[model samples]
Target: MKKTKTRLAAIAAVALSAVLACGVLAGCASDKGEQKASEQPEQTAAASLEGKSLNIYCGAGMTKPFQEIADAFKAQTGCEMNITFANAAQIQTQINTTQEGDFFIAGSADELKPVSDYVATSTDLVKHIPVLVVPADNPKGIQTVSDLVKCDTLLLGDPESTPIGKIAVKAMTDAGVMEQVKQSGSITTSTTAPQIAEALAKGEGDAAIVWKENAGKDGLTILENSGMEGYVKTVPSAELTCAADADAVKAFSEFLQSETAKNIWTKFGYELV
Candidate 1:
């Protein structure tokens, strides 16, 4: 009976040990399962954009602000950006031909009209104003569109390809001195407003009608703003139909409206729209 009781006690001990071991294993499994469940969504999100990149076709004038914005976006979202800068017309043409770009930023709304079919949505990002830019010392006494007639070399954007040039022509025409200015000043033209600004800074031309932001460069000063006709332009941004990742594209679009982007734009002499 002693042996029987001893054997019975041993059996009970074995049973209890087995039960404890099972419980411990189950507890460990439960903890591991909970950890995996929490990590799954994070892993999936990280995987989604692990190798993804976005393409943006932007206007040359917006390079400064957009580049800063792009850096901030990549740090926050872990997505990469490829940006192409050119005149609005050239970018629009590329959008039409390639059908591969993700976003388009035009210096003016008119630049978006021709490629309306490719643009899925648009928002006014900022206001652009065209101004007469001259060397730091207001040589030649240029103060208004009328005064452009006295410049030895007058630089402007290519009206056929750039918004600034088109607006410059209108302002000159409205000022009723388009013909006189052309005849008096040696007319020089560039493909983009920013280029014209550079030319004016280098003294390549005595005067250049460029965007107000461009005129903010160190060695340049605004002689006069081509009053409100061509000067009061809005910079518009659009998401094209060819966007591969709509969520990523939309996120960037929203970022453009964010306070961070607004600060950068303002720093670059752009007013939010």
Candidate 2:
């Protein structure tokens, strides 16, 4: 009986040893695959929908060109992204009270700082704003600021709360005719900056104070004529508040004024500051 028990014990030990050997080999194979993966060159992660989401508060008109660029960022960066567009005043107001977004593109740098009211982190990124435009035909015979005001055409800009509207109102006031003109009922207000030109082109209004970039297109007369260019200033920032995704915001912000964006900007009649 003792001899028989020893033989059985030897068989059990060999089986256990064989199982341990197979487990060790399997672990080594997995480790090799992990090491190989780590050794490979890292891939650039362009902006992606499945990655991190970046919120942008900026001019709605920028949506098209911005998306075109963001599409490429996705192909490369793998970061998620989203944008919330609004007029200058609306954005500033929201930034002051509401939770801020990852980035802020102000029409003027002067307008961007309010983001700090809620969020402590912010950075100015780019600058741009409206330049007056008229019809290609120069209907009502508009030429310069003075001529623009004299005509029976509509003067365009956001309403009073908007920075550009305030600037435009102030400019017209400085030129000595803000109230007189408003009193005369000669002007009409639009929501977004782009609407200035759209209103003119669509014949909803006559002349408009549009962004320079929004001018230069077909069927529009650029009334951003020399010397009367004192209507506004441009400013923007990539950082604002406690942005949840700072990296992606910084990346896209850097591209806002990039040559590529500038080209599209100029195409729209906006001049670089």
Candidate 3:
């Protein structure tokens, strides 16, 4: 009878060990399930706007930085962006005619005036500064706004179509030399900043007033204190009334002011407001 009791005791011990082992395995499974559940919310949030798309009207000068921002936004939310780039006036006309864009990003706040009634909300993103750029080696010896009269050919943006053109006129006018600058040289009008930069790079013009960021192009030198101070324009991004997806537009609008977007703008030579 004692031998039989010893065997029974050994069996009972094995059974207890098996039960504890099973309990430990079950606890591990529970922990894993909780971890997976905790991660779901983040995944869901990242893909909340998946399969959605937005139409954006952007200024031509902002193409580089805004393109990178749009790519980053697409990666985070899996949404697609259709960007239309042109001079501010052209973009304003497109927005009014189409009546179908999610956001409007302009070189200046003034560009948004015609579309103000269509803008649901707006935010200032950066500074649009105009600077005088000349070809390398200062071929014309132009050193100041007053010296612009020396150039046989001077490129200026069209005040009716470009923010830089308006700012250039105002800067020269503010310094009391607009008429002389015009009379001393042939004032050639461009429709966009890149066009002015391109014209300068090819030696098509002696000097041009363009956005400060455009001065980064090759074969150009920005002249300091050429009388453009205090004529800075504010770059503004606005959500339009024609936004097809409000949530997606809101998400992108918020992203425009994020640190990531600011870094891109700075990388492209833009100054944050």
TM, every model: 0.80, 0.72, 0.86
Q: lDDT tens string, model 3, 1-273?
A: 999999999999999999999999999999999999999998898799888999999999888889999999999999999999999889998988889999999888888999888999889999888898999888889888878778888899999998899988887887787898877757999888888899889989999999998888888999987777678888888989889998898889878878999999999998899
Residue lDDT tens for model 1, 1-273: 999999999999999999999999999999999999999987676446545688998889789888998888776667898999999788888989988888888888999998999989989988988888788887787878878888889999999999988998998889898999777747889998878888888878778888888887788988644353445988888889999997788778877888888898899998788
Report the error of model 3 at residue 67, Å: 1.2
What is the C-alpha local distance difference test score of each model?
0.84, 0.64, 0.89
At residue 256, what lDDT does model 3 achieve?
Answer: 87
lDDT per residue, candidate 2, 14-56, as tens digits? 9999999999999999999888787654443332334677776
Q: After superposing candidate 1 on the true structure, give the runs of residues whose Cα lies further than 4 Å from its correct spot.
A: 1-48, 224-230
Question: In terms of lDDT, which candidate is strongest?
Answer: 3
Deviation (Å) of 109 in candidate 1: 0.5
Candidate 2 versus truth, CA RMSD in Å, comes to 10.9
lDDT of 2 at 97: 67
Which candidate model has the greater lDDT, 2 or 3? 3
Predicted structure with the largest TM-score when compared to the true one: 3
